[model samples]
Target: MRGSFRIEGHAIASEDGMIAAANGLMPDSLKFPSDQKLYEQALDQAAVIANGRLSYEGQLNSPRRKRLVLTRSVSGLAPDPKNPNARLWNPAGESLEAACAALGVTGGEIAVVGGPFVFSLFLGIGYDAFHLSHAPGVRLPGGVPVFHEQGSGRSPEDVLAAAGLKPGPVQRLDDGVTMVEWTRAA
Candidate 1:
Protein backbone atom coordinates (compact mmCIF):
# COMPACT_ATOMS: atom_id res chain seq x y z
CA MET A 1 0.00 0.00 0.00
CA ARG A 2 2.96 2.33 0.41
CA GLY A 3 5.15 1.37 -2.51
CA SER A 4 5.27 -0.71 -5.69
CA PHE A 5 4.14 -4.37 -5.49
CA ARG A 6 3.86 -7.36 -7.80
CA ILE A 7 0.36 -7.81 -9.39
CA GLU A 8 -1.05 -11.08 -10.79
CA GLY A 9 -4.47 -12.14 -12.09
CA HIS A 10 -6.30 -13.78 -15.03
CA ALA A 11 -8.84 -13.31 -17.84
CA ILE A 12 -10.69 -16.45 -18.97
CA ALA A 13 -10.86 -15.84 -22.70
CA SER A 14 -7.90 -13.97 -24.11
CA GLU A 15 -7.08 -14.85 -27.72
CA ASP A 16 -3.45 -13.91 -27.08
CA GLY A 17 -2.81 -16.34 -24.19
CA MET A 18 -3.20 -13.57 -21.63
CA ILE A 19 -6.88 -14.29 -21.11
CA ALA A 20 -8.25 -17.19 -19.11
CA ALA A 21 -11.03 -19.61 -20.05
CA ALA A 22 -14.53 -19.60 -18.56
CA ASN A 23 -13.65 -22.05 -15.81
CA GLY A 24 -10.79 -20.43 -13.90
CA LEU A 25 -7.77 -22.14 -12.32
CA MET A 26 -9.67 -22.47 -9.06
CA PRO A 27 -12.38 -24.96 -10.07
CA ASP A 28 -15.65 -22.98 -10.40
CA SER A 29 -17.10 -21.21 -13.41
CA LEU A 30 -17.91 -17.51 -13.43
CA LYS A 31 -21.33 -16.29 -14.40
CA PHE A 32 -18.74 -14.66 -20.41
CA PRO A 33 -18.93 -11.33 -22.08
CA SER A 34 -19.18 -9.78 -18.62
CA ASP A 35 -15.45 -9.42 -18.17
CA GLN A 36 -14.96 -7.97 -21.66
CA LYS A 37 -14.10 -4.49 -20.42
CA LEU A 38 -11.62 -5.94 -17.97
CA TYR A 39 -9.88 -7.79 -20.77
CA GLU A 40 -9.84 -4.55 -22.77
CA GLN A 41 -8.05 -2.87 -19.88
CA ALA A 42 -5.58 -5.72 -19.79
CA LEU A 43 -4.85 -5.16 -23.44
CA ASP A 44 -4.48 -1.46 -22.77
CA GLN A 45 -2.06 -2.16 -19.98
CA ALA A 46 -0.15 -4.50 -22.27
CA ALA A 47 -0.03 -1.73 -24.85
CA VAL A 48 1.37 0.74 -22.34
CA ILE A 49 4.05 -1.74 -21.32
CA ALA A 50 4.68 -2.66 -24.93
CA ASN A 51 4.83 1.00 -26.00
CA GLY A 52 7.32 1.95 -23.30
CA ARG A 53 4.90 4.24 -21.46
CA LEU A 54 5.49 2.98 -17.93
CA SER A 55 8.33 3.62 -15.48
CA TYR A 56 10.82 6.51 -15.46
CA GLU A 57 13.78 6.60 -17.82
CA GLY A 58 15.06 10.14 -17.44
CA GLN A 59 12.20 11.11 -19.74
CA LEU A 60 9.63 8.35 -19.15
CA ASN A 61 10.66 6.20 -22.11
CA SER A 62 9.33 2.62 -21.92
CA PRO A 63 8.28 -0.29 -19.78
CA ARG A 64 11.22 -0.97 -17.49
CA ARG A 65 8.95 -3.29 -15.50
CA LYS A 66 11.05 -6.41 -16.25
CA ARG A 67 8.18 -7.98 -18.18
CA LEU A 68 8.14 -11.72 -18.83
CA VAL A 69 5.28 -12.49 -21.15
CA LEU A 70 4.13 -16.16 -21.29
CA THR A 71 2.81 -17.32 -24.64
CA ARG A 72 2.67 -20.55 -26.62
CA SER A 73 3.35 -18.70 -29.82
CA VAL A 74 6.51 -16.63 -29.52
CA SER A 75 6.18 -15.27 -33.04
CA GLY A 76 4.09 -12.28 -32.09
CA LEU A 77 5.29 -8.71 -32.59
CA ALA A 78 7.89 -7.37 -30.25
CA PRO A 79 6.51 -4.97 -27.67
CA ASP A 80 9.54 -3.14 -26.32
CA PRO A 81 12.53 -3.15 -28.62
CA LYS A 82 14.74 -0.83 -26.58
CA ASN A 83 15.59 -3.77 -24.34
CA PRO A 84 13.30 -2.40 -21.63
CA ASN A 85 11.67 -5.82 -21.36
CA ALA A 86 12.98 -9.32 -21.75
CA ARG A 87 11.38 -12.25 -23.53
CA LEU A 88 9.84 -14.86 -21.28
CA TRP A 89 11.95 -17.85 -20.23
CA ASN A 90 9.02 -20.09 -19.53
CA PRO A 91 9.43 -22.35 -16.43
CA ALA A 92 13.06 -21.62 -15.83
CA GLY A 93 16.00 -19.27 -16.55
CA GLU A 94 13.73 -16.38 -15.51
CA SER A 95 13.80 -16.19 -11.75
CA LEU A 96 11.48 -13.67 -10.11
CA GLU A 97 13.92 -12.92 -7.29
CA ALA A 98 16.66 -12.21 -9.77
CA ALA A 99 14.39 -10.13 -11.98
CA CYS A 100 13.21 -8.08 -9.02
CA ALA A 101 16.79 -7.40 -8.03
CA ALA A 102 17.78 -6.50 -11.57
CA LEU A 103 14.81 -4.14 -11.93
CA GLY A 104 15.62 -2.34 -8.66
CA VAL A 105 12.15 -3.09 -7.33
CA THR A 106 13.24 -5.24 -4.41
CA GLY A 107 11.66 -4.27 -1.12
CA GLY A 108 9.39 -2.24 -3.34
CA GLU A 109 6.17 -3.44 -4.92
CA ILE A 110 6.63 -5.93 -7.73
CA ALA A 111 3.79 -6.65 -10.21
CA VAL A 112 2.97 -9.87 -12.09
CA VAL A 113 -0.16 -9.93 -14.25
CA GLY A 114 -1.01 -12.57 -16.81
CA GLY A 115 -2.74 -15.92 -17.42
CA PRO A 116 -2.74 -18.72 -14.84
CA PHE A 117 0.46 -20.26 -16.13
CA VAL A 118 2.46 -17.12 -15.44
CA PHE A 119 0.93 -16.80 -11.99
CA SER A 120 2.04 -20.35 -11.32
CA LEU A 121 5.56 -19.41 -12.34
CA PHE A 122 5.50 -16.44 -10.00
CA LEU A 123 4.05 -18.62 -7.30
CA GLY A 124 6.92 -21.03 -7.71
CA ILE A 125 9.28 -18.09 -7.69
CA GLY A 126 7.62 -16.59 -4.63
CA TYR A 127 5.29 -13.78 -5.65
CA ASP A 128 2.44 -12.43 -3.61
CA ALA A 129 -0.80 -10.62 -4.37
CA PHE A 130 -3.51 -11.76 -6.77
CA HIS A 131 -5.99 -9.18 -7.97
CA LEU A 132 -8.44 -11.24 -9.99
CA SER A 133 -11.95 -10.77 -11.33
CA HIS A 134 -14.72 -13.34 -11.09
CA ALA A 135 -16.23 -13.48 -14.55
CA PRO A 136 -18.72 -15.92 -16.05
CA GLY A 137 -16.57 -18.99 -16.71
CA VAL A 138 -16.60 -20.55 -20.16
CA ARG A 139 -15.40 -24.00 -21.14
CA LEU A 140 -12.89 -24.53 -23.89
CA PRO A 141 -12.65 -28.29 -24.48
CA GLY A 142 -9.02 -28.22 -25.56
CA GLY A 143 -8.19 -25.19 -23.44
CA VAL A 144 -5.14 -25.02 -21.23
CA PRO A 145 -5.29 -24.92 -17.45
CA VAL A 146 -4.24 -21.81 -15.55
CA PHE A 147 -1.22 -23.45 -13.90
CA HIS A 148 1.17 -25.65 -15.78
CA GLU A 149 2.82 -28.79 -14.51
CA GLN A 150 5.84 -26.93 -13.18
CA GLY A 151 3.66 -24.07 -11.92
CA SER A 152 1.48 -26.42 -9.95
CA GLY A 153 4.39 -27.25 -7.65
CA ARG A 154 3.37 -24.68 -5.09
CA SER A 155 0.37 -22.87 -3.69
CA PRO A 156 -0.03 -19.33 -5.04
CA GLU A 157 -1.28 -18.00 -1.73
CA ASP A 158 1.70 -19.43 0.11
CA VAL A 159 4.11 -17.70 -2.20
CA LEU A 160 2.06 -14.53 -1.95
CA ALA A 161 2.19 -14.53 1.82
CA ALA A 162 5.91 -15.11 1.87
CA ALA A 163 6.38 -12.39 -0.68
CA GLY A 164 4.28 -9.98 1.42
CA LEU A 165 0.78 -10.38 0.05
CA LYS A 166 -2.37 -11.44 1.84
CA PRO A 167 -6.08 -11.71 1.16
CA GLY A 168 -8.11 -8.51 1.33
CA PRO A 169 -11.68 -7.42 0.81
CA VAL A 170 -13.44 -8.91 -2.20
CA GLN A 171 -15.07 -6.34 -4.49
CA ARG A 172 -18.02 -7.91 -6.24
CA LEU A 173 -19.25 -6.15 -9.32
CA ASP A 174 -22.92 -6.05 -10.36
CA ASP A 175 -24.55 -8.95 -8.49
CA GLY A 176 -22.54 -12.18 -8.82
CA VAL A 177 -19.36 -10.75 -10.30
CA THR A 178 -16.58 -9.60 -8.02
CA MET A 179 -13.03 -8.20 -8.07
CA VAL A 180 -10.88 -9.76 -5.38
CA GLU A 181 -7.94 -7.71 -4.17
CA TRP A 182 -4.91 -9.04 -2.29
CA THR A 183 -1.82 -7.39 -0.82
CA ARG A 184 1.64 -8.41 0.30
CA ALA A 185 1.65 -10.15 3.65
CA ALA A 186 2.90 -8.04 6.52
Candidate 2:
Protein backbone atom coordinates (compact mmCIF):
# COMPACT_ATOMS: atom_id res chain seq x y z
CA MET A 1 0.00 0.00 0.00
CA ARG A 2 1.19 3.51 -0.76
CA GLY A 3 0.44 5.92 2.05
CA SER A 4 -2.52 3.97 3.48
CA PHE A 5 -4.03 3.35 0.06
CA ARG A 6 -3.82 0.10 -1.88
CA ILE A 7 -3.87 0.54 -5.63
CA GLU A 8 -5.53 -2.08 -7.81
CA GLY A 9 -6.06 -2.17 -11.56
CA HIS A 10 -9.07 -3.76 -13.20
CA ALA A 11 -9.47 -4.56 -16.88
CA ILE A 12 -11.08 -7.02 -19.28
CA ALA A 13 -9.35 -7.56 -22.55
CA SER A 14 -9.54 -9.56 -25.74
CA GLU A 15 -7.15 -12.47 -26.20
CA ASP A 16 -5.00 -10.29 -28.40
CA GLY A 17 -4.46 -7.87 -25.49
CA MET A 18 -6.85 -5.20 -26.68
CA ILE A 19 -9.03 -3.47 -24.14
CA ALA A 20 -10.89 -1.34 -26.66
CA ALA A 21 -11.33 -1.24 -30.38
CA ALA A 22 -9.53 1.26 -32.59
CA ASN A 23 -12.32 3.77 -32.03
CA GLY A 24 -11.57 3.78 -28.26
CA LEU A 25 -14.71 1.80 -27.51
CA MET A 26 -14.86 -1.55 -25.80
CA PRO A 27 -16.47 -4.04 -28.09
CA ASP A 28 -19.30 -6.20 -26.80
CA SER A 29 -17.23 -9.30 -27.47
CA LEU A 30 -15.12 -8.52 -24.44
CA LYS A 31 -18.09 -8.12 -22.11
CA PHE A 32 -19.36 -11.03 -20.08
CA PRO A 33 -22.03 -11.00 -17.39
CA SER A 34 -19.97 -12.96 -14.88
CA ASP A 35 -16.92 -10.79 -15.42
CA GLN A 36 -18.96 -7.62 -14.94
CA LYS A 37 -20.46 -8.97 -11.73
CA LEU A 38 -16.95 -9.42 -10.31
CA TYR A 39 -15.86 -6.03 -11.60
CA GLU A 40 -18.82 -4.24 -9.99
CA GLN A 41 -18.18 -6.01 -6.70
CA ALA A 42 -14.58 -4.73 -6.72
CA LEU A 43 -15.72 -1.17 -7.48
CA ASP A 44 -18.15 -1.39 -4.59
CA GLN A 45 -15.18 -1.92 -2.30
CA ALA A 46 -12.97 0.85 -3.67
CA ALA A 47 -12.43 4.11 -1.78
CA VAL A 48 -12.12 5.87 -5.10
CA ILE A 49 -12.05 4.90 -8.74
CA ALA A 50 -9.42 6.39 -11.08
CA ASN A 51 -9.54 6.43 -14.83
CA GLY A 52 -9.23 8.44 -17.99
CA ARG A 53 -12.26 10.40 -19.22
CA LEU A 54 -12.98 7.82 -21.90
CA SER A 55 -13.04 5.00 -19.39
CA TYR A 56 -15.31 6.98 -17.05
CA GLU A 57 -17.81 7.89 -19.78
CA GLY A 58 -17.95 4.29 -20.98
CA GLN A 59 -19.43 3.15 -17.73
CA LEU A 60 -23.14 3.68 -17.07
CA ASN A 61 -22.67 3.30 -13.30
CA SER A 62 -19.74 5.69 -13.01
CA PRO A 63 -21.82 8.27 -11.17
CA ARG A 64 -22.42 5.82 -8.35
CA ARG A 65 -18.82 5.83 -7.21
CA LYS A 66 -16.45 8.46 -5.84
CA ARG A 67 -13.85 8.82 -8.60
CA LEU A 68 -10.77 10.58 -9.88
CA VAL A 69 -10.74 11.41 -13.55
CA LEU A 70 -7.18 11.79 -14.86
CA THR A 71 -6.94 14.70 -17.22
CA ARG A 72 -4.38 17.23 -18.45
CA SER A 73 -6.99 19.96 -18.75
CA VAL A 74 -7.00 20.39 -14.99
CA SER A 75 -3.99 22.22 -13.56
CA GLY A 76 -3.83 20.02 -10.54
CA LEU A 77 -7.01 18.92 -8.83
CA ALA A 78 -10.46 20.42 -9.19
CA PRO A 79 -14.08 19.43 -8.77
CA ASP A 80 -15.15 17.48 -11.81
CA PRO A 81 -17.44 19.70 -13.86
CA LYS A 82 -19.42 16.72 -15.10
CA ASN A 83 -19.71 14.75 -11.88
CA PRO A 84 -19.96 16.19 -8.42
CA ASN A 85 -18.76 12.92 -6.91
CA ALA A 86 -15.46 13.12 -8.81
CA ARG A 87 -12.36 15.25 -9.15
CA LEU A 88 -10.47 16.03 -12.32
CA TRP A 89 -6.82 15.27 -11.58
CA ASN A 90 -3.67 16.13 -13.46
CA PRO A 91 -0.95 13.76 -12.23
CA ALA A 92 1.71 15.84 -13.98
CA GLY A 93 0.96 18.69 -11.60
CA GLU A 94 -0.20 17.04 -8.38
CA SER A 95 0.55 13.75 -6.69
CA LEU A 96 -2.11 11.11 -6.13
CA GLU A 97 -1.90 11.71 -2.39
CA ALA A 98 -2.81 15.38 -2.81
CA ALA A 99 -5.64 14.50 -5.11
CA CYS A 100 -6.98 11.89 -2.71
CA ALA A 101 -6.76 14.34 0.14
CA ALA A 102 -8.78 16.86 -1.84
CA LEU A 103 -11.41 14.18 -2.40
CA GLY A 104 -11.49 13.48 1.35
CA VAL A 105 -10.24 9.93 0.76
CA THR A 106 -8.47 8.79 3.88
CA GLY A 107 -7.55 5.21 3.04
CA GLY A 108 -8.78 2.17 1.16
CA GLU A 109 -8.37 0.68 -2.28
CA ILE A 110 -7.84 3.05 -5.22
CA ALA A 111 -9.28 1.12 -8.12
CA VAL A 112 -7.53 2.02 -11.35
CA VAL A 113 -9.93 1.42 -14.17
CA GLY A 114 -8.66 2.52 -17.55
CA GLY A 115 -7.94 3.49 -21.08
CA PRO A 116 -4.43 2.26 -22.09
CA PHE A 117 -2.69 5.39 -20.86
CA VAL A 118 -4.26 5.16 -17.43
CA PHE A 119 -3.37 1.50 -17.11
CA SER A 120 0.17 2.22 -18.21
CA LEU A 121 0.33 5.05 -15.68
CA PHE A 122 -0.48 2.85 -12.67
CA LEU A 123 1.82 0.11 -13.89
CA GLY A 124 4.59 2.63 -13.36
CA ILE A 125 3.14 3.97 -10.11
CA GLY A 126 2.86 0.33 -8.99
CA TYR A 127 -0.23 -1.67 -8.19
CA ASP A 128 -0.80 -3.82 -5.14
CA ALA A 129 -2.78 -6.07 -7.41
CA PHE A 130 -4.21 -6.11 -10.91
CA HIS A 131 -7.26 -8.15 -11.83
CA LEU A 132 -7.19 -9.12 -15.48
CA SER A 133 -10.10 -10.84 -17.17
CA HIS A 134 -9.80 -12.10 -20.70
CA ALA A 135 -12.11 -13.32 -23.42
CA PRO A 136 -10.69 -16.21 -25.42
CA GLY A 137 -10.91 -16.29 -29.21
CA VAL A 138 -11.78 -12.62 -29.35
CA ARG A 139 -9.28 -10.42 -31.11
CA LEU A 140 -9.16 -6.75 -31.99
CA PRO A 141 -6.15 -6.41 -34.27
CA GLY A 142 -5.94 -2.64 -34.32
CA GLY A 143 -7.54 -1.89 -30.97
CA VAL A 144 -6.33 -0.01 -27.94
CA PRO A 145 -4.12 -2.31 -25.86
CA VAL A 146 -4.24 -2.80 -22.12
CA PHE A 147 -0.78 -1.15 -22.01
CA HIS A 148 0.66 1.43 -24.42
CA GLU A 149 3.87 -0.56 -24.76
CA GLN A 150 1.82 -3.49 -26.03
CA GLY A 151 1.99 -1.92 -29.47
CA SER A 152 5.76 -2.31 -29.25
CA GLY A 153 5.25 -6.11 -28.97
CA ARG A 154 4.83 -6.58 -25.23
CA SER A 155 1.79 -8.53 -24.08
CA PRO A 156 -0.20 -7.31 -21.10
CA GLU A 157 1.13 -10.22 -19.05
CA ASP A 158 4.63 -9.40 -20.25
CA VAL A 159 4.19 -5.79 -19.19
CA LEU A 160 2.85 -6.76 -15.78
CA ALA A 161 5.57 -9.31 -15.17
CA ALA A 162 8.20 -6.80 -16.22
CA ALA A 163 6.75 -4.47 -13.59
CA GLY A 164 7.36 -7.15 -10.95
CA LEU A 165 3.89 -8.58 -10.58
CA LYS A 166 3.25 -12.32 -10.51
CA PRO A 167 0.05 -13.96 -11.62
CA GLY A 168 -2.12 -15.94 -9.26
CA PRO A 169 -4.27 -18.89 -10.21
CA VAL A 170 -6.55 -18.32 -13.17
CA GLN A 171 -10.27 -18.86 -12.69
CA ARG A 172 -12.78 -19.39 -15.40
CA LEU A 173 -15.52 -16.81 -15.11
CA ASP A 174 -17.70 -18.05 -17.92
CA ASP A 175 -17.71 -20.22 -21.03
CA GLY A 176 -14.94 -18.33 -22.74
CA VAL A 177 -13.85 -15.88 -20.11
CA THR A 178 -11.20 -16.28 -17.43
CA MET A 179 -9.90 -14.06 -14.67
CA VAL A 180 -6.57 -13.79 -12.90
CA GLU A 181 -5.16 -11.60 -10.21
CA TRP A 182 -1.54 -10.48 -10.50
CA THR A 183 0.07 -9.31 -7.29
CA ARG A 184 3.25 -7.37 -6.76
CA ALA A 185 6.21 -9.61 -6.13
CA ALA A 186 7.71 -9.56 -2.67
Candidate 3:
Protein backbone atom coordinates (compact mmCIF):
# COMPACT_ATOMS: atom_id res chain seq x y z
CA MET A 1 0.00 0.00 0.00
CA ARG A 2 1.22 3.52 -0.71
CA GLY A 3 0.60 5.99 2.08
CA SER A 4 -2.58 4.41 3.47
CA PHE A 5 -3.94 4.05 -0.04
CA ARG A 6 -4.14 0.50 -1.34
CA ILE A 7 -4.22 1.12 -5.07
CA GLU A 8 -5.10 -1.88 -7.22
CA GLY A 9 -5.80 -2.40 -10.90
CA HIS A 10 -8.02 -5.01 -12.53
CA ALA A 11 -8.11 -5.97 -16.17
CA ILE A 12 -8.74 -8.94 -18.46
CA ALA A 13 -6.85 -8.89 -21.69
CA SER A 14 -6.42 -11.05 -24.76
CA GLU A 15 -3.36 -13.23 -25.18
CA ASP A 16 -1.98 -10.48 -27.40
CA GLY A 17 -2.41 -8.02 -24.49
CA MET A 18 -5.38 -6.27 -26.10
CA ILE A 19 -8.09 -5.12 -23.79
CA ALA A 20 -10.30 -3.71 -26.52
CA ALA A 21 -10.81 -4.17 -30.23
CA ALA A 22 -9.76 -1.67 -32.88
CA ASN A 23 -13.26 -0.23 -32.60
CA GLY A 24 -12.36 0.82 -29.04
CA LEU A 25 -14.69 -1.69 -27.49
CA MET A 26 -13.91 -4.65 -25.30
CA PRO A 27 -14.68 -7.81 -27.19
CA ASP A 28 -16.60 -10.64 -25.59
CA SER A 29 -13.62 -12.89 -26.14
CA LEU A 30 -11.84 -11.22 -23.24
CA LYS A 31 -14.66 -11.64 -20.77
CA PHE A 32 -14.61 -14.56 -18.36
CA PRO A 33 -17.01 -15.40 -15.57
CA SER A 34 -14.14 -16.11 -13.22
CA ASP A 35 -12.59 -12.76 -13.93
CA GLN A 36 -15.87 -10.88 -13.62
CA LYS A 37 -16.53 -12.40 -10.22
CA LEU A 38 -13.13 -11.46 -8.92
CA TYR A 39 -13.39 -7.99 -10.40
CA GLU A 40 -16.74 -7.33 -8.76
CA GLN A 41 -15.53 -8.60 -5.41
CA ALA A 42 -12.51 -6.37 -5.57
CA LEU A 43 -14.60 -3.35 -6.45
CA ASP A 44 -16.91 -4.09 -3.58
CA GLN A 45 -14.01 -3.76 -1.18
CA ALA A 46 -12.69 -0.58 -2.72
CA ALA A 47 -13.50 2.82 -1.27
CA VAL A 48 -13.59 4.38 -4.73
CA ILE A 49 -13.24 3.27 -8.33
CA ALA A 50 -11.54 5.28 -11.08
CA ASN A 51 -11.70 4.84 -14.83
CA GLY A 52 -11.83 6.70 -18.10
CA ARG A 53 -15.14 7.66 -19.70
CA LEU A 54 -15.23 4.59 -21.92
CA SER A 55 -14.60 2.22 -19.06
CA TYR A 56 -17.17 4.03 -16.94
CA GLU A 57 -19.77 3.91 -19.68
CA GLY A 58 -19.14 0.23 -20.38
CA GLN A 59 -20.24 -0.66 -16.87
CA LEU A 60 -23.17 1.72 -16.50
CA ASN A 61 -25.28 -0.67 -14.45
CA SER A 62 -22.46 -1.64 -12.17
CA PRO A 63 -23.17 -1.59 -8.44
CA ARG A 64 -23.41 1.93 -7.12
CA ARG A 65 -19.92 2.26 -5.78
CA LYS A 66 -18.42 5.72 -5.55
CA ARG A 67 -16.55 6.43 -8.79
CA LEU A 68 -14.34 9.06 -10.39
CA VAL A 69 -14.75 9.26 -14.14
CA LEU A 70 -11.80 10.68 -16.03
CA THR A 71 -12.80 13.12 -18.72
CA ARG A 72 -11.42 16.27 -20.27
CA SER A 73 -15.00 17.56 -20.16
CA VAL A 74 -14.35 18.81 -16.66
CA SER A 75 -11.68 21.28 -15.69
CA GLY A 76 -10.92 19.36 -12.55
CA LEU A 77 -13.45 17.65 -10.29
CA ALA A 78 -17.17 18.19 -10.77
CA PRO A 79 -20.40 16.49 -9.91
CA ASP A 80 -21.55 13.77 -12.24
CA PRO A 81 -25.00 14.99 -13.31
CA LYS A 82 -26.21 11.49 -14.01
CA ASN A 83 -25.01 9.78 -10.87
CA PRO A 84 -24.98 11.24 -7.43
CA ASN A 85 -22.39 8.69 -6.37
CA ALA A 86 -19.98 9.71 -9.07
CA ARG A 87 -17.74 12.63 -9.94
CA LEU A 88 -16.40 13.72 -13.28
CA TRP A 89 -12.65 14.26 -13.09
CA ASN A 90 -9.87 15.50 -15.27
CA PRO A 91 -6.56 14.30 -13.86
CA ALA A 92 -4.65 16.53 -16.24
CA GLY A 93 -6.03 19.53 -14.41
CA GLU A 94 -5.81 18.21 -10.85
CA SER A 95 -4.02 15.73 -8.67
CA LEU A 96 -5.49 12.33 -7.85
CA GLU A 97 -5.29 13.08 -4.16
CA ALA A 98 -7.42 16.17 -4.61
CA ALA A 99 -9.91 14.30 -6.74
CA CYS A 100 -10.28 11.60 -4.08
CA ALA A 101 -10.59 14.21 -1.41
CA ALA A 102 -13.43 15.83 -3.32
CA LEU A 103 -15.26 12.54 -3.13
CA GLY A 104 -14.61 12.25 0.63
CA VAL A 105 -12.38 9.24 0.06
CA THR A 106 -9.47 9.72 2.42
CA GLY A 107 -7.73 6.37 2.34
CA GLY A 108 -8.65 2.90 1.14
CA GLU A 109 -8.50 0.79 -1.93
CA ILE A 110 -8.69 2.81 -5.15
CA ALA A 111 -9.82 0.24 -7.69
CA VAL A 112 -8.67 1.25 -11.14
CA VAL A 113 -10.53 -0.44 -13.94
CA GLY A 114 -9.38 0.63 -17.36
CA GLY A 115 -9.11 1.45 -20.97
CA PRO A 116 -5.43 1.62 -22.05
CA PHE A 117 -5.05 5.28 -21.17
CA VAL A 118 -6.46 4.85 -17.67
CA PHE A 119 -4.26 1.84 -17.00
CA SER A 120 -1.23 3.69 -18.27
CA LEU A 121 -1.98 6.65 -16.02
CA PHE A 122 -2.14 4.47 -12.89
CA LEU A 123 1.01 2.64 -13.94
CA GLY A 124 2.77 5.99 -13.89
CA ILE A 125 1.25 6.74 -10.49
CA GLY A 126 2.18 3.24 -9.23
CA TYR A 127 -0.09 0.44 -8.10
CA ASP A 128 0.16 -1.65 -4.96
CA ALA A 129 -1.13 -4.64 -6.92
CA PHE A 130 -2.53 -5.35 -10.35
CA HIS A 131 -4.80 -8.30 -11.07
CA LEU A 132 -4.23 -9.29 -14.67
CA SER A 133 -6.34 -12.05 -16.16
CA HIS A 134 -5.83 -13.60 -19.54
CA ALA A 135 -8.20 -15.24 -21.98
CA PRO A 136 -6.21 -18.04 -23.51
CA GLY A 137 -6.39 -18.62 -27.27
CA VAL A 138 -7.74 -15.15 -27.87
CA ARG A 139 -5.92 -12.45 -29.74
CA LEU A 140 -6.96 -8.98 -30.80
CA PRO A 141 -4.48 -7.80 -33.32
CA GLY A 142 -4.64 -4.09 -34.18
CA GLY A 143 -6.52 -3.59 -30.96
CA VAL A 144 -6.02 -1.46 -27.87
CA PRO A 145 -3.26 -2.78 -25.67
CA VAL A 146 -3.48 -2.94 -21.90
CA PHE A 147 -0.66 -0.40 -21.89
CA HIS A 148 -0.41 2.66 -24.12
CA GLU A 149 2.52 1.61 -26.29
CA GLN A 150 2.12 -1.31 -28.69
CA GLY A 151 4.24 -2.94 -31.38
CA SER A 152 7.15 -1.41 -29.52
CA GLY A 153 8.84 -4.68 -28.62
CA ARG A 154 7.51 -4.53 -25.09
CA SER A 155 4.94 -6.99 -23.82
CA PRO A 156 2.47 -6.17 -21.05
CA GLU A 157 4.71 -8.15 -18.71
CA ASP A 158 7.60 -5.96 -19.70
CA VAL A 159 5.54 -2.86 -19.00
CA LEU A 160 4.50 -4.11 -15.56
CA ALA A 161 8.01 -5.13 -14.68
CA ALA A 162 9.27 -1.74 -15.78
CA ALA A 163 6.76 -0.27 -13.36
CA GLY A 164 8.36 -2.36 -10.56
CA LEU A 165 5.62 -4.95 -10.24
CA LYS A 166 6.47 -8.64 -10.02
CA PRO A 167 4.07 -11.40 -10.91
CA GLY A 168 3.01 -13.82 -8.22
CA PRO A 169 2.34 -17.50 -8.86
CA VAL A 170 -0.22 -18.05 -11.59
CA GLN A 171 -3.68 -19.38 -10.79
CA ARG A 172 -6.00 -21.17 -13.15
CA LEU A 173 -9.35 -19.45 -13.20
CA ASP A 174 -11.80 -21.10 -15.58
CA ASP A 175 -11.89 -22.67 -19.02
CA GLY A 176 -8.18 -22.13 -19.53
CA VAL A 177 -8.32 -18.55 -18.21
CA THR A 178 -5.48 -17.75 -15.83
CA MET A 179 -4.64 -14.90 -13.52
CA VAL A 180 -1.53 -13.39 -12.02
CA GLU A 181 -1.41 -10.96 -9.16
CA TRP A 182 1.35 -8.46 -9.89
CA THR A 183 2.60 -6.66 -6.83
CA ARG A 184 5.31 -4.13 -6.12
CA ALA A 185 8.67 -5.81 -6.42
CA ALA A 186 10.16 -6.45 -3.01
- Among all candidates shown, the one with the greatest lDDT: 2
Clashes of each: 26, 0, 0
Point out where model 3 deviates above 4 Å: 1-3, 57-63
Candidate 3: worst-modelled 10 consecutive residues by lDDT = 56-65
Candidate 1 Cα deviation (angstroms), residue 130: 0.7
Model 3 lDDT per residue over 7-95, tens place: 89998889888889999988888887788888888888899999888885344346478888988998888999987888898888888
**Using TM-score as the measure, which candidate wins?**
2
Residue pairs with clashing backbones, model 3:
none
Comparing 1 and 3 on TM-score, the stronger one: 3
TM-score of each: 0.46, 0.95, 0.93
**Per-model lDDT:** 0.42, 0.89, 0.85
Better of 2 and 3 by TM-score: 2
Worst 10 residues of 1 by lDDT: 47-56
lDDT of 2 by residue, 57-124 (tens): 34567687899999999899999888888999999998888888888887899999998888998988
Tens-digit per-residue lDDT, 1-186, candidate 1 = 212444444433222122334443322343233454554445345321211122112213224445545443434323334455554332344344444444444444344544455555555555444665544344344444434531434433444455566778866555445555665565
TM-score of model 1 vs. true structure: 0.46
